[model samples]
Each structure stands twice: as C-alpha cells, then as structure tokens.
Target: MNPLTVLRDSLYFFQRNLSQIVTLCLPLVIVEAILQRIVDDAVGPDASAGFGLIVGLLVYPLYTAALILFLDARSRGESPRNRELLAQAVNLWPRFALLSAISTLLIVLGLSMFFIPGIFLTVVLAFSEYRLVLRGEAPLAAMKSSFNLSRGHFWRIFVCILAVLGPLMLLKEFSYSLFSKDDNTLLSLVLDSANSFLQLFVSVVLFRLFMLISDKSDQ
Candidate 1:
C-alpha cells in the first residue's frame, strides 16, 4: 500500500462522496466552530487552549463516529441515511469521546518529550478510533491493538497523514493571514468550518489504511 495509492484512492472516495459527507458532517462541524468562537470571545486571548479542546470533545465524536460509520457502509455497498448514522453515532459518543480524550492526552504527553515520541505515538495510535467505533473494542484495548497493528507500517501511515495535513496547515495559516479573525467574523467562521471539514479527508485516508492493513493481517 503505497502512500500515493492510498491518497489517490482516498481522494477519489472523498470527491465521489463529497455531498453525502457534507450533508452528514458539516452541520456539526460548523457548530463546533461556532462554539469555539463563542469560547474564544468569552475567554479573550489569554484563555487556555484546553477550553477549545473542551468544545471539540463536546461535538467532535458525534460527527467523527458518524463519518466512520458512513465510510464502513459505503465500503460494504450500503447507503445508510444520515439520521440513521447520526443516531448510531450518538449511541457511540460516550465511549468515542472518552477514547478521543485519552488518545489526545497520550499524544500531547508524548509531544512534550522532544516531539518525536509524539509523532511516533500519533502514527501508532492512528487506528484506535476505528477499532473502537467499528470493531467494538474498548478504548484502551483498541489503542493497544492499534499499537500492535501499526508495527513495521509506521512510515506508510505517517507519510499519508503528513501529505494530507501539511498542505492544510499551510492553507489555514495563509487564510488566517489574509482574513484576520478580528476583522471578519463571518469569513473566519467559514474558514474554520471549511478547514475542519477538509480535515475529514485525513479520516478517509486512515480508514482506508485501516481496512487494508486489517484485511492483510487477517490473511
């Protein structure tokens, strides 16, 4: 599974399913961005970043779990309704949110140690969400399985993630420079929502990798 092939396939899937994805996930993404803006305004510039992470924890798992379910449905040649996906996602939210929190904490801790360990943890723990959401593994168990599953495949997964996020990071900076949030609240909101929505592509790529690796490992 070359990174390029994985990216190409993922992009194709993302493009083909763009409308469905937008319909299924964009509203919650926008809500998250709006809540973030509210928190920023409420706390002012000196607020701890953890407040923003709290906003994310409130909404991120809902749409993320829904998207993962949508991806799985499409893979199996099924077309599930948005409400159905959202309902199922709601049910998964408690565990998924806890899983997200733990994963974020571990990544952040690893990042505090010279940065490289965090990157390594990021690659290795990539599939934990899928294991939890799709395979019904508990949070810690899923993380353990993902660590074991990612062995010898670190570079492949890391490269794909970098390729997808690198350009996004640059574009986000550029957009912020061009349209200062203080000057244009509406535009800033649009930019924030768009950026978060596009980041879903990374999810698509990782889901693709997860499926491929799991299938191979099963053989």
Candidate 2:
C-alpha cells in the first residue's frame, strides 16, 4: 500500500465526515480532559509519574477502535446511530481492559530485559483493537492475532502511525509551550482533547487501510 495514497484517502475521509467524527469523539474528549488534569496533578519536577502516563497512552487504542467501528458501520451504509455503536463498542471494554493489563505487564517485563522487547511488544499489540472489532475475535485472541499480523509489518505500521500522528503531537507540544504560561493546566487539557480527536481520525483511517489490505491479500 502506498503511504501517500493512504494519507490522502484518510484526510479526505476525515474532511468529509468531520461532523460525524466529532460527534462520536465528544465523550472521549471529556474523558481525556479529566485524564489530562490527573496527569498534570500527578507529575512533578523530580519524580516520574510513570503509571498514569502509561494508562493515558493505552486509552487511545481502546477508544480509537470504538470510534472506528462506528465509522466503519456508517461507511458500509449501516445504521451508525451513536447509541447502538457505543453499546456495541462498550461491550468490548472488559476485553480491552484485560488486554491493556496483560500488555502493560509484558511491557514492564520487557523493559527489565532491555528496551527493545518492550518496543516490539508495543508495535505488535498496536492493532489489537482493529482485530477485535473487524474480525469479531475475543480480546486475547485479537491481541495474539495483531501480534502475528504485525510481525513483518511492524515497522510499516509504526511509520504510518508516526506519519499521521507526529505532526499533531508536535503541534500540541508547541501550543502547550507557547500559551501555557497563564494556566498551563487548562491549555494542556485542551491539547489533550484535540489530540484525542486527531488520534481517533487517524485510527479509523489506518484501520480502514488494514482491512483493505487484509481483504486484498485474502482474495
């Protein structure tokens, strides 16, 4: 798959469905605002606020999957009512929570061995939600499948994620650096909310590309 093509299509999709996408992401924005506040409060000059940052990172994939599943339904001309899609997505919460816990443990263990294994496990598990929602697999099974599918494609996915997410992240950092003097707390929270929305858009785009590639390979 061509990266440029994927990026273009993803941008087009995001532009066309902006309103619907924003609607789907509203709840996540609220949650992220709360989380950002917690993180700001927890982190300090000398101490590392490790666990909270980790939790904050993991929240992205779970919610991204939920939002993408809803978008996918709408793209297929199915009923994509917020309530129905959210109910279906929420059903996977327990599974997401379990997978997050297991992945976190493995990552921590991997870090003990060295940093490479931890990074490897992270990229491998990156697409777990896509597998869960698209293939209708159980959570652990989805995690395993994502690991397998991502083996040769890990770097590709990593690059794709960065390509889509890096600029937005940089912008957030820049904004926080510039205007956060008066009250960095509120500014930081707003940045988090915007980042969450951008992430959802990127996730849906990447998930759609993955599904397209999977289908082509199957045929």
For TM-score, the strongest prediction is 1
Clashing pairs in 1: none
**Can you write out model 2's per-residue Cα lDDT over 85-204, one digit (the tens) per residue?**
667767777666666677777877887787889878767887777777778778789888888777667777777777877898898778777776337666666677777677676676
| Candidate 1 C-alpha lDDT tens digits along 100-207 | 999998899999999998999999999999999999999999999999999989999999999999999999999899888999889989999999999999999999
User: All candidates' TM-scores?
Assistant: 0.99, 0.81
Per-residue lDDT value at 219 in model 2:
92
* CA RMSD, predictions in order: 0.7, 3.1
Model 2 / residue 76 / CA error / Å: 1.6
TM-score of 1: 0.99
Q: How many steric overlaps are in each model, in order? A: 0, 0
Candidate 1: stretches off by over 4 Å: none
